[model samples]
Target chain A: DVKVTQSSRYLVKRTGEKVFLECVQDMDHENMFWYRQDPGLGLRLIYFSYDVKMKEKGDIPEGYSVSREKKERFSLILESASTNQTSMYLCASSLTGSIEQFFGPGTRLTVL
Target chain B: SQQGEEDPQALSIQEGENATMNCSYKTSINNLQWYRQNSGRGLVHLILIRSNEREKHSGRLRVTLDTSKKSSSLLITASRAADTASYFCATDRGGYQKVTFGTGTKLQVIP
Candidate 1:
């Protein structure tokens, strides 16, 4: 089975604080993504990486940024956290152009 | 972004009954996938239907796609408590790399 691991299962950060959520995949997939799921809003992509050090912004990438320093790890960074940023964050990895993705346990982040 | 929209936002059914959820997207896609999420946990992939294909099945789950209509449906036969979860349909235009999720359907299978 493909495994994607998120650095934290739950996190609490104060407003204006910086936060980092990490994800690592064992499948060596070329694509990695980060998303924040809000009630009724579903899951909105924050960022995705196609290769090492390569990234692209998704639908809701305004307050977030991502980094892929290596093939297996991708990180999502919140420059300045806000209460509105509280949501369930998910990490996913997949092969290039493949619809089959493997997901990591979500990180429920609360920004106070 | 570009996530499909699921109909009947929520549904409840007795075990052994069938549950169906619909999803509609705005643009053309190379494939559509269904994923199930339990409570606040991670998502598990259920099935994927290519845009060129019309239908597919896995276990008791059946998925049908209407590319011309830009819509799809998922049916769970003889539903069980384990089938209770939020189901989302993701659309990916063939680079297959850019897949977006839909607002999910919350299903509850009452025993």
Candidate 2:
């Protein structure tokens, strides 16, 4: 089975703090994504990386940014965390041209 | 902007009963995918139907796509409690590696 692991299952941070969420995939997939799921809003893509050092902004990328320095690792960064930034963040990865994405367990971040 | 919209935001059914969810998209797509998410967890891909295909099946799950109508439907036969989850429909637009997800339909199977 494909394994995707997140650095933290839960996190708490104060306003204006910088927060980082990490994701790693064992499948060597070429595509990786970051999403934040809100109630009634489903899962909204924050950012995605097609390959190492390549990044693209998704629909809701204003408050978030991402990094993919290596193929297996993807990281989401919050420049200045706010209470509104609290949400369940998910990381997913898929092979090139594949529609099925394997996802990590998710990190529930609380910005207080 | 969101591309897909799923109908019947929430559903409840008795075990063994069939459950169906509908998704409608706004633009052209290369493919449509169904994903299931257990409470407080990540999503699991259930099925994917290419734009050219009309229908596909995997075990007890059946998926139908109507590209002309920009819509799709997913049906689960002999539903079990384990099938309880939030189902989401995602659309993959041809290039730029863009994919959009719908709000989702929450299904509850009573055993």
Candidate 3:
């Protein structure tokens, strides 16, 4: 079975603290994406990487960054945790030229 | 930013009834896909219909795509309580491997 594992299922952080949410996929997919899901807003893409060391900003890339140093691992970074930044973060991986994407369970982050 | 909007933000139905949700997108797409998310879990891809295809089915799930109207719909036949979840429509614009997701329709199947 294809699997995508996240570093944490829940996290709490203080304001101004740095946060890291890690995702690893066993599928060895070429494309990785990071998204923040909020109520009514849906899943807003933060960043995506099609290849190692390459990243593209999505519609809601502000306040967030991503790192894909390896094929199976993709990490999302929050430079400064703010109350507004608290949301469910999801990571997904898909093969190149494929329409289907496998998503991780997700990390619910809380900024206090 | 969301590219698609699903109509009827919430829907309630009996276990044996069918549930249908519609999605309308702004731009032309290479393909459209439907996904289901149970509660706080991540989305699971239900079906994918390319721009050239009109209707497609997988098991009890049927998806229809109309490129002319830039819209799509998903129908779940004889939905059970296990089918209760938020359904979303995602559009792939072809390049960059990026797809935009809609707000999603919250479905409730009461037994």
Candidate 4:
């Protein structure tokens, strides 16, 4: 069984403030992804990392950025948090490509 | 962008009854997978069927894929209360790292 540990299960940040959401996976997966899910809109990808320090933008990456400083850890950063950035953020990792992705519990963020 | 199009966005079934979900997609794929997600939680992998395969089963869950039609279906036999969740179909594109997901079908199993 793979365990994806997210630093926070719930978060609240004020507008214009910088926010960081951290995720770590015990399994050494080559690919990691960040997604924000909204009600009725489904899951929209933010950013993904294929290897250390390597990244790519996904479907919705306008207000977010990511950092993969190490193999087991991936972080999502909101340069300037806005009310629109509030949503359920999910982290997932996989061996590569579209193979089964092991997902984190999720972090519910509320931007004031 | 590639997407897995799912039909019957929502369903309600009685306990002990069977439930079925369908998925359709465009473009070629290497494999198709099913997933389950509870309210406010991350998704759990249910089953995976490759393009070459027509049908596969795991426990009470059955999945079928029709490449000629570019579609697939999932059947949950004798569903229980715990089986109630949002079901999604994901397609593994021929590319190494492009996997797209469907909008999902919300299944409610009434007791």
Candidate 5:
């Protein structure tokens, strides 16, 4: 069984604050992704990393960035949080050639 | 941009009944996968059907894909109370190493 863990299940921050969400996967997957799920928008990809120090912008990457300093850890950073950035953040990882992804418990962020 | 869109934003069915959901995509895909997400939780992989295959089954879940129409359907047989959750369809567009997910259909099973 693969385990994906997030640093926080729930987080709250004020506007213009810097926020960091961390994700760790035990499966040693090569691909990692970050997404924000909204009510009607579904899951919008924020960023994805295929390897350490490598990141690609997803459909909705504005105001967000990512870091993959280590193979097992990925982090999502909000330069300056805004109310519009508040949403459920989900982290997922998959192998290089495998399309099946394992997701970590989401972090529901509230930007006041 | 979301690659897939699921039909019927919400569905309600009685326990022991069957529930079906549909998903439509815009482009060619290497594979389509279904995921179940409990409220406020991460998604769990349900099944994956490759483009070369038309139908696939796992336990009580049956997934069908139509490449010509770029559509897919998921059928849950003998639905149970624990089956109440949101179902999402994801599409992998080959080498991107990531998939795009649909809005999801929220299913509620009445006991």
Candidate 6:
């Protein structure tokens, strides 16, 4: 089974605080992605990594960054949490060049 | 800019009825996929239709794609209360596996 796990289901942060969201997938897939879901706006990709140490910016990568130091783990970093960055964050992984992505449960972050 | 746009931002239906949703994109795609997400949960992949294929089915779910029109539709037959969730359409524009997702359609199935 493809299992994707996130470090937290819910997180609260104060403005200007740095935040780190961790995701680990057991599928050993070559591609990993980070996305944020907002009400009415749906899910927008923040960043993705095709291989270890490789990353690409997605549609909404302004306030976020990502890391893939290992094949099974991916991390999303918020330089400084802001109210506008409060949303449901999701992580996903897929086999090389495959379209079907397995997703993690998600982390709901609240910034105040 | 080229993203899938799902029609009917919200829908309400009774259990055992059929619900259909449409999606339109602005560019050519290698494949189109449908997914369901329960409130506060991750998305569940439902189906995928290739650009060369016109239609595909998975149990109670049916998906149709029109590459010429850059549109697709997902139909759920005999929907149940468990089917109440948000549905999204994603398009793979055929290169490095970058997929763009649509806003989504919120479905409410009253049992």
lDDT of 5 by residue, A5-107 (tens): 9999999999999999999999889899999999988999999999999999999999998999999999999999999998999999999989998999999
- Name the candidate that leads on lDDT: 5
Considering just the first chain, candidate 6 attains a TM-score of 0.98
True lDDT of residue B105, candidate 1: 97
Q: Pick the candidate with the highest DockQ.
A: 5
Model 2 is docked with a DockQ of 0.73
Error of 2 at A67 (Å): 1.5
lDDT of 3 by residue, B1-111 (tens): 579999889999999999999999999999999999999999999999999999999999999999999999999999999999999999988997799999999999999
TM-score of chain B of each: 0.96, 0.97, 0.98, 0.96, 0.98, 0.97
Q: What is the TM-score of chain A alone in each candidate?
A: 0.97, 0.98, 0.98, 0.97, 0.98, 0.98
**DockQ scores for all the models shown?**
0.77, 0.73, 0.81, 0.56, 0.86, 0.76
Q: Which stretches of candidate 3 lie over 4 Å from their true place?
A: none
Report the lDDT tens digits of candidate 5 across residue range B9-29: 999999999999999999999
- Segments of candidate 5 deviating more than 4 angstroms: none
**Tens-digit lDDT track of model 6 for B6-66:** 9999999999999999999997788999999998999999999999999999999999998
Given candidate 4, what's the lDDT at residue B78?
Answer: 98
Which lDDT tens digits does candidate 2 get at residues A13-99?
Answer: 999999999999999999999999999898999999999999998888998888899999999999999999999999999988777
- Model 1 pairs whose backbones collide: none
DockQ metric, candidate 5: 0.86
For candidate 6, the per-residue lDDT at A80 reads 94
lDDT of each: 0.92, 0.94, 0.94, 0.89, 0.96, 0.93
Interface RMSD, prediction 6: 1.0
